[model samples]
Target: MRLPGLILIVLATLVPVIWFAPLAGERDAVALFSQYLGASALILMGINQFLATRVAGIETIFGSLDRIYILHKWLGVVALVAMGLHDIIDAEMNGLRGGPLSGIAEDIGEVSLYGLLILILASVITFIPYHLWKWSHRLIGVFFLMGAFHYFFIEKPFSNFEPLGLYISAFCILGIVSYVWMSLLRPMTPRGHVYEVDLVRRVGGLTELVLLPKGRGMKHKPGQFAFLSINDGALGEEHPFTLSGAPAQDRSLRFSIKDLGDYTKRLHKTVEPGMEALVCGPYGHFSMPKGRDPQIWIGAGVGITPFLAFAESLRTADAGPVKLYYCVREQDDVPYAVELENIAEAVPNLELVIVNSAEGIRLTADRIAGDLDGDLSTAHVFFCGPVAMRKALKTDLVLKGMRASRFHFEEFEMRTGIGLRVLAAWLWDRGVYELEKRNSALRQPAE
Candidate 1:
């Protein structure tokens, strides 16, 4: 089965356990429950990683999939909160605070502390835009391992009755073990392409890099991304980066990055050729053609990276005709400027329009339509950029009466579980409100 399908299934099966946890017991039950929540969240993260590598052309949502991305991230947040509550109650209930250094309570307390630390680290790292936070964020994988250990040995929630309790507990622990083993220890090279940094250069205000695989072709479709890591750093953390080059006919891959944070800043001053990098992925659904008709690509700033890959692929007859209306703050902000035009020249169907806003050039979808000659409604718009710009474009598309199936975007959400739960809860609340409104209207005397 595809990784996305498998991951979603695992998560869906586990969701019921957490949902029913409150009914199993009292306050301690809630605390006990939190550990499982964390376990589930970590597992989902692993699932997402697996999906990125194993699934092809699979998206989290059918329409503009930002909703799924948000859900995944928020679910991680919920898991964090649950772990916090788990620690507090477990500490107080077991008198763990008073235990000796080597006692069970101390170990549990230490584990809880570590879990909290992981949450803090992941949350903090996510705040930085793209490449800066990208590399270091891979450390969360280590924390996920720590959390799994904490889940099983921390509280020993097996102290319950009936078959389902122990059965589910064992299932959860097994899942955690499998996820951790696959994530940190296992390597995905498999006799094909292993990643290596080709060149790291200073372009405009950013440090951009070119990546190529070692000994094998780094095969991927256009509009996909790969995770990156520098092996030589004090903190060898991996981050996801969108492919910025045309899809390789020979399996070579390329990436462009900017120094948006501490990780990239170091890359600017330090990263070099011949050094190895851990690259995992080619994930995301920001692609142009995906069982759809003509596509429209919307971009801003470095978000244009993936679209450049799409356009490049179109240039080489890699896929199909894809029209691009890329937005940038200034003419200079567009990466691979000459290459983008060169490809457009080679492929007549691939139209590239640059809105130079540095001196105040304004643009919208209406302006974008002038560049292409086709049924605009048939085009599925793909976007990757700052959150403000992304949201604005989505709103614009909505106002244009574009169908949901005709829009797509990518936001590399850092977390993965709580958002879905919250969205579900919110939806539940709205349903309740509508029912209440109808009830009140029915109660009123008819005029």
Candidate 2:
């Protein structure tokens, strides 16, 4: 977890306690604690919305969107737990309540809780299609608004909780503001660079798109990704993809997208040369450092895209010994395999280790540990692959005395839109990834 995000979560959890501790002695103990729980959850949720904003400062502090998403996920779980505790503890208070407004408030709170649960669950389960999941995510703002209504109108032990009520109200307002900006305003804003589709190739089961900027191109480092939205019949939905090649003077960009879902499946057929697209950002920090020790690069299937960029960046440099472990089910499944081989042959310090699971070759941590000729402690390991692979390798390597900080990976699996459809697609892809990994593992050569 990023230090700033961790700090924010700690403060958000503790500040509410600090604010309400003085009033604890004046009110019923259980009632005051429940109110405090609810208040802290709301504050955390507001901070959650803020962190989701792709602000430069937050991204820098959080290190990358990958870490940001992790913090975002944990905060959501904490908020939900807090809200659940609040509901249970406050359930008996309704029997002693005396007004119509209080009953209405209780009803609103109940509804918000249920709605939030559904939305968060949809987000957690990636099997939900992206289109439906996208909509489900947006409904959170509606639930938050209702929660704010409940907070303001409800009968409370600390009804006169001074500016605390006002503070929560501000959070509610900001939550709505962030929802509007992300779902509406951000998409409407023109991209930093507009590109014409120079070429679209269907290779294996993936679509390779080549983009040529129409005006001044956005400068980006290798291994970073960009969001692309085609103006053709493809709904103009922006999708993040890693740059598959080094920075060039022509400012041409290439994205190798695997046909995992509906959007990508139709990409080759729907997108054509001369088509225009809005390109925003070269986001992410999945790159190697210049002064670091030998690098261990791992890429599985389409995850090889970033490694291609990294290899391109290292072509002219005399970096220390680097080994790339490229994994795929078959020779044909490896994207950019030929180009990668050519680059590896040209760079003396770079070595390519191709692992074809079809032939019972597996790229496990123990296998890598055995293959390395030098001390593993001084090597920086970078991975871009399925979440399961990353987790397994990271765990196994860490247990073998490798520092966790020496391992890094990028997570492109994100809740992009505020809809259930998007969620479903993400979930569906995640399920497929896990299944593929399992099938591949079953084919591995036994030790």
Candidate 3:
């Protein structure tokens, strides 16, 4: 979402190559390139560790925590690939002799590479439970430490005091510090505002938590989310949930959590009134748009949580003429449906539309266009839903004269796969499409 952060990552990866090139002397070209890949891998892995810390204000550089995590996931994959290449390409420098500990360091490097591969695979595989995956992910820091040890002790072309060596050494220190802070120090320290559970209401698979501030509560806007961690033993892990109510003077926060994962299911069953919890945010930029321009808000299933906060905030805030679409598979599955309807009634500029797919009703782009007086070019559409639904709707709406820039949604999947199958299928489809287009053009006769 932001350019500078990504630009910095690219610069970090390439600058070392330039710095090391002048000192290459008569080294083997392929072997030296392999060494550069190793340096790039270590640098990228260091950045990954820093991102994992979730430092405050870092999200501003990357847009949101969701996007930050996406970058984090891909960077790890790329780093692993780079490491694999470095290993396979044979980086033994000519006339470079090992020090006393070089043999042990090289062995550690091999172990780190294989350990990282297994851990990263565990992360990519979706069948593993979240807690187990998280634990395995934490083990990455161990391998990183091992790799850093190898970098320090293994015989290389440059001395530790050289520019190239110093640059990489800095990242090694950064990686180690980040890992320690995140895995060791940060957890020992108390973070975020403490709150007591004011209410726990369950409706079907949805669990609503209203948290009352124990001391100073977090300040947040509508459509923001917080990481909530209940103090109960099994439920102590922090999980992100969108705030489902408008910010009030009481400083109470509301979270509408769907029982989608193990942690959430446990929270639904075990959480109760008066339970102590920690709330570590008010994160995200999924707020309502300003100005009097026409706006369309679409929320599918539990994706409606943020829109609930937006709707509640509309009671006082001055804004646009808005059409809110609440899409659900069944009528009974809609959380806060009545509340949303009431808000729509109270807010003169707001309108509510319910699309129940189970009753053979669909929220199609043509239907939306028709409702907006057969023109979609002037309207801004905000959506929160499943990935397939978002992709399809965005494609259709853009084709129906809506500007691509006006279609907005948070790309907020916490655990996404490496997408090997998706990429292969997309490439295959594109090739077939191109071939068909070429054949059609050839048969068109002097077009």
Compare candidates 2 and 3 on TM-score and give the better one. Answer: 3
Regions of model 2 farther than 4 Å from truth: 91-103, 157-161, 190-192, 331-333, 415-447
278-372: candidate 1 lDDT, tens digit per residue? 66665655666645366677677777778777776664464445666666665444566677888888887677777667868766655555544
TM-score per candidate? 0.66, 0.86, 0.93
State the TM-score for model 3.
Answer: 0.93
- Per-residue lDDT for 181-212 in model 3, tens only? 99999999968999999999986568999999
Candidate 3: segments with Cα more than 4 A from true spot: 331-333, 420-447
The better-scoring model by lDDT among 2 and 3 is 3
Tell me the tens digit of each residue's lDDT in model 2 across 1-447.
568768866775676566677866666678788888888778778777777667667777766776677677767777888899998885344333235687798899999988887787677776789878767777887787788778777876444346665666677677767777776787677546899999888766678888998998878888899878898766387777888878888888988889878777667668889999888787888878877488899999888889888899887765888999988997455667788899988998889988999898888778777776535787889999887789999999887767898998898676532345676789999999999999999999999
* Better by TM-score, candidate 2 or 1: 2
Better of 1 and 3 by TM-score: 3
Q: TM-score: which candidate is best? A: 3
Candidate with best lDDT: 3
Please report the TM-score between candidate 2 and the true structure.
Answer: 0.86
> Per model, how many backbone clashes are there?
14, 25, 0
